[model samples]
Target: MSERKPQVLLIGFGGVGTIVSYTLEHLGRAEVTVVSRPETYDSIKSGYRIESCSYGIIDNYIATNVVKSTKEGYEKYGPFDYIIITTKNIPEISPVVDFLEDCYHESSTIVLIENGIGIEIPIYRKYPKAIILSGVSLIGTTLYEDTVKHIARDIIKFGAFINYNLDKQMQYDRCKHFLSLYSNDNNFAEYEENVKLTRWRKLVYNTCINTTCALTDLDFGRMDLFGGMESVVRPAMKEVVAVAKSEGVEIEDHVIDEMIRGEDGVYYPPSMLIDVRNGNYIENTVIISNVVKYAKRNGVPIPTLTVLDNLLKLVQLRTGEAKGRFELPEKRPLPEENYQIQFKY
Candidate 1:
């Protein structure tokens, strides 16, 4: 008899999701069942043509199974060994915990491959018994229509989210086993003993550079053109480092410079900017507000992050209200326009 491959259920079908699904199946180590929306279900079910810089061209790829909703996936492929979530971490519209309620089992090992800081707290709180592996992925993959373009680096650091309720050794073993599944020459995967520190390090880039680029409507190269690196970017990163230190995670001072230098000449658009462009709500809570929370707890003054947080809240409010994600407020008529002076250029 042939060896039984591990059964996996992956949620989300965006750029990151596509790459993960392809990688999992490429080695034939796991049989993946994907959960995607009904709108793009057919297109994804047909196949994905991936153009990865690391893995080269992989034509006409599809998962072992594709389902529309998490409930459906659970009913069809219930009690999966591993459940990986690579969706946008937007809690207002949909919480990651809600998805788990539908498919979670006692033995399932959950893996989070999303962005933002402190994202694992809620999950760990809810599923205290289950082993949760936190993943910090450093890849630049974009899904446009049908094709997935893997643009930049492909590296992921995995570590177990500390759960006091579970055995530490068991958590470590599960995390290591899960990490082993993604072992391939095309991508880099490693175990991080202090993954939270890894997360804080990434936040130095996400909280500062990603948020700044989104708010200013510019890419990395353009942000550099405006001297943002010296003025706002570096200072904001320093603030992030301070916040991380407050949380007991000591991020190196040189990481700020390294992060800035990483995007020196690249014109890449950060995820927050892409969300703004797509009219989707930015990840304000996890990316910024959570850090602000930490800073306030430790009495660390983060004036730059506070200002950025307020601005991002306004942006999120506008986007959320437009999308009807929030309760509609009482509608009122606008005040009469005052006399306006016309100016000729």
Candidate 2:
């Protein structure tokens, strides 16, 4: 008899979530159930039209099952073999540990396909015995309504997150099994011996390009139009490398140039920029502030990152104010001369 397929529960069915679910179902290796927010549940439940450069256009793509919340997912599909979270790593708004309360089990392996460094710490602390796999995806995909556009790369590097509570060999074995199910010809996957280093490498881009674009409200191509590559992008990336070095992660200077060249002419709206446009809180803490804290602990100076972090905090404040998530005293009205300055332009 054929072995039973692994049962998987995936949370946050956005661009990354959609790609992961589609790939798992497309390969016919796993039984996938997704937990999406109530707002987008109906739309996603109907179907998705995926325009993928790697896998070609796929019409009416749907998962094995779709549910609204983690509670519903757990009640319907309990004892899941793998619980994958591809949600935005906004701990203040939605903590990662909250999602696992209902679904997580002793046998369940938690897979984190989210961004930012130090993302797996909280989960590891909470579920010490659970085997956690960190997935670093370099794919550039965006979801518009019911359509998902996989524009650029499709690569994911997976490694077992360091958990002293669990046996190292067992964690690696689980990671390898998941890799076998996820990787295919077009959707490339590789094993990473040191996932923390991989995360820091990706942060070299996220902390620099992603934050810069959100602050300037520019796409990849447009950022280059204003000489941001040499002025802002590269400098911030160098700071990231410095901080990583202090933590004993060696990232060569050439990686910076290679990353810049990779998106040389592409017009891509990074996830952070998209959040800004939608009046959503930017991932300031995980993506930027965490690195800043690291730099401080090791006495590694990161002036560029410091400036970026401060600016992003202001951006986050603006988003919070716009969304009414923050309550502040009414602003004093501007003087008549302040209004008149607009006409001078």
Candidate 3:
């Protein structure tokens, strides 16, 4: 008798998906299958290519299997060991429960490698028996044309999502097994005991830089060139810390200084900015609105975040109307708030 390799199914094959798949393949830790869009699936079927600054170039790294949707994937490769979702955390627009409902099994653990806090609540509501994990992704990646590119390296904080609305603990066995797949220094993967606290820490950077750059239609390098670090960026980043504290998640004050370091200023565009420019749905509800929701519930005042939230909602409306992706380049002005203090409840 021989040992069977772990069976891992990822619901997306974009930048994050490709990078994670490559890492898993290199380690020979799992038999990786991908559920991709029609276009991405076709591309993979013909020939899958990945370009990376870290791993050089891989022309054809064969996957175990590639399917178009979760239903198809489940029918073919049912009862996976692990399911990793790399799509955006947009519940209202594109609920994950739709695709992931059939994909999870009794023993399958789902890992989310997307951005935003307050994202797992809905999933917990749908699948009470399923174990979910959050991957606080800090790595820099981009999907262009048909290639997945890894521009820089960072860490992914992994922890179990025991409760929907609150932070607590469950069996650490699954989490430990997942982390053990990678070497200690391989790709900077870490197991986080307090995942919610880590979520808040990442939020300071995402809520501030991602929303601002996304709305302004500017990259980090352009923001540096225009010089808004102390005036705009710092204030926004500082506000996140306050909201996190009100929610009982204490992020050190000095993180603002660390976030403002010079090296972070680069030509890269954050995920939100890329989503907006591509006419894709922005993650306003989960990222910005949820923070405001928690802050108001805790009676914490985040005037700056309030302004940013409102401004973003209005911009999101225009984006929906303009159909930014299909709209002509010239008409879609290469540029761009909302203030609403309400919860999804």
* lDDT by residue for model 1 (53-113), tens: 9889989888899999878988998889999999888776578888898889987899999
In angstroms, give how far residue 178 of model 2 lies from its true place.
Answer: 0.3
RMSD of 2: 5.6
Candidate of highest TM-score: 1
Q: What does candidate 2's lDDT look like per residue over 1-345, in tens digits?
A: 989889999997878888999888797899899887888888888999999998899998988888887788888987888999998888766788888988889989999998898888888788878788999998888899899999876799999987888789888899999999899998889999798899999999899989999999998778877888889989999999999999899998899998887545668878899899888877888899999999999998888999999999888767766776655545654675353211110
Stretches of candidate 3 exceeding 4 Å from the true structure:
164-170, 183-185, 225-227, 324-345
> Positional deviation of 127 in candidate 3, in angstroms?
1.3
Residue 212: error of model 2 in Å? Answer: 1.7
TM-scores, all candidates, are: 0.93, 0.91, 0.87
lDDT scores for all predictions? 0.87, 0.87, 0.77
TM-score of 3: 0.87
